[model samples]
Target: MVSLRAIVEDETTLLNALSLTIPEREELASITHPAQRIEWLACRLAVRRLVEAQGVPYAGLQKDEFGKPHLIDSPWHISLSHTTGWAAAVLHRSRPVGIDIEPIRDQFRRVVPRVLSDKEITHAASDLNRLAVYWCAKEALYKLYGKRQLTFRDHLHIEPFADHEDQLVGHVRLPDHEEQLMIRCFRTGPGLLAVAY
Candidate 1:
């Protein structure tokens, strides 16, 4: 089973509603920036909700050297993503998962070279939102890969698809591994949400 949740951040209620245990509080205490603090809390809360729904007590989360988050002493896989005012989490009983939340921006074009191949750019064509879809789909796939080393332009590939489609498949190729990821996209207010597994 896979559980997903996304919520717009409310700074006022975030702290009041979140009753983080001492360890979880310590994990985020170093974050001085308000935005970062909010995102961190929102993600933990989302994950907390998922685990609670599944009748599992919430454990603290930790990260590996690659910064992929894992629930302490739990076998379930988790992925998190957030922007300034939104956060999302995905929990999977067995399969690995990835989720990303991104705000569409005109500046995304400037970073196209770093994130997309020539063919991908051609596939996105002149439209900007389609570019957002490609960028977001790739971001989700990158998170799905979990490791920190892969390059979006080199290791990730997004097959062409309509911007209106509910889902898309992403490809990953490495010297030692290959995977086909199923990614789903949705309109999240002003930004985009992509989840993969």
Candidate 2:
């Protein structure tokens, strides 16, 4: 099972709203862009909230060599995603998990060829909502893989589903190994969230 949470707030409320370790403070300082810093803070605070909800001490986060964030001193696997003003996080007890949030936009139409495969493109039919779902699903799959070698069009595949469906099938195809995962979608405030595990 996976637990998910989303946080939406203004810049002032999020600033210094959560406790940070020395390393986390330094990491925040290293981020130069104001928007990026806000995103970083929001994601950390959101994930920390999830950790505390489970009655566990939030020891902060650590990234593996592949850049996947893991809960320090805990057995939970975690994934995070943020866009503009929304940040989301997912946690699973014993399985790798991925979650992505994205707002539907016209730009998905332009990036269709780059993000979706021929089969997926045919299934999407240039619809913005479908394309947005595909994008979020693939991004969740990519984060689940937790490696940098895969491409959306080549390695990650999401089976076609009907409009208004909340569940879909996703496959991560590699040269030597392949695994199928179940993906769940939710209608978040102004966007869609896809969770793969």
The candidate maximizing lDDT is: 2
Say which candidate scores most in TM-score: 2
Clash count list over all predictions? 0, 0
Model 1, clash count? 0
Pairs clashing within candidate 1: none
Candidate 2 versus the native: TM-score? 0.91
* Model 2 lDDT at residue 162: 93
Candidate 1 stretches with Cα past 4 Å from truth are 1-27
Expressed as tens digits, the lDDT of each residue in 1-197 for candidate 2 is 33334455555677657777787778889999877778788888888888888888788887888878888888888998887777788888789999998888998898888889999999999888899999999999999899998989999999999999999999999998899999998877558999998
